[model samples]
Target: MHGWLTTPPGPGPHPVVLIIHGGPFAQVTVAVSDETQVLVDAGYAVLACNPRGSAGYGQAHGRVIRRRLGTVDRSDVLDFLAGALADAPKLDAGRLGLMGGSYGGFLAAWLTAHDQRFTAAIVERAFLDPETFLGTSDVGDFFVEEYLGPSRALRNAQSPQELVDRVSTPTLLIHSEQDLRCPLSQAERYYFALKRGGVAAELAIFPGEDHELSRGGTPRHRLQRLELILDWWDRYLPVRPAPHART
Candidate 1:
């Protein structure tokens, strides 16, 4: 699960964010961190992971991803991030963020449930429910079978809806209104459930948009989405000034 780490300006005690790369096989590392400049500029240490199942390493690593989404991959995310807290000295361990798009979004939401260490989370176009996703998703119909196996129950177990109750972290879900890959309704379901459970959550749905909101959406809207994520983290994971002021 080793990925890459980007250094930020200034010294110790800066907020840290784990940027998970999506795609059952794609790899986005520290070298691929242009989208994270805003987080770095806002004084946050960014840890980008390619994880166990990400591509570009070899077929051996990438092939294990089939039918192993939440089981092994999720563990890699939580455990690797928890380990990074000890290694990255400049990072403020107490103030943390989890962010990504699509499969990365699923990792963010899954981390919200599996790990309590993250102070805040930003999930974009997340495949919230793999069961429903398989049924409703336009693109998922073709890819879900490959990654999740032929079992619907496996997809259910991989879904955030199956585990959303375990999440209490403040989560911000960003998605497109017309995303056929994951569907905006998936985000809606988690948003409503998180609110119902009294867990802090919000969903930002961009109208007339699709799955590639990250690359194809209006520039202004994407900027707004980025700002919203930073603001969410600041509100929940702000750094403590001193030992006594930390309360």
Candidate 2:
């Protein structure tokens, strides 16, 4: 596991936001982005990483999680976060948040259910139910076959919907109504299950937007999305003001 960590200036112990990259085979570089800067500026430490099954780490590492969607990748992320917290004493492990889109969004939901350490989560364009997703998504069959193989039971077991009842972390779901890749129904089903399970969850839908909502949506909507994320984190894992400013 490889990652980049950025801390806010003059911080003693800061809340941490773990940003997971989208593709199950993609890599997260050390580059800084406006989105990450926003969190850093607001006094949150941001940690972005490339876990196992991510590209740029050779073919063996990238293919290690094949046919095992939620198992190895999930453990890799958890281990990476734990190691990061251990290395950085200024990071507050108790006030942890997770943010990601697409495949990463799926992991966010998976982690929220399997782990109790995360205080909040921002899930964008997530794939919640493998059964439903196989029918609705444009790339459903290919995605399922490529990553999960042909086992129906295995797919259901790995889907986020199956574990929604265990999620207690406050979650904010951002989905694009016109998204054909993952589809909006993914978000709807997850939100419904979360509500039914008594979990703190909210869903935000962007009209006329697709899977590219975060990367190439209208400028106004992108800004709105960032604001929504910030608001969610503030509501759940708020960054306390500096001592000098408090007085």
Score candidate 1 by lDDT: 0.80
TM-score of each: 0.91, 0.95
lDDT of each: 0.80, 0.89
Residue 31 error for model 2, in Å? Answer: 2.7
lDDT of 2: 0.89
Clashing pairs in 1: none
Give the worst 10-residue stretch by lDDT in candidate 2. Answer: 238-247
Per-candidate alpha-carbon RMSD to the true structure:
2.3, 2.6
Q: Which candidate tops lDDT?
A: 2
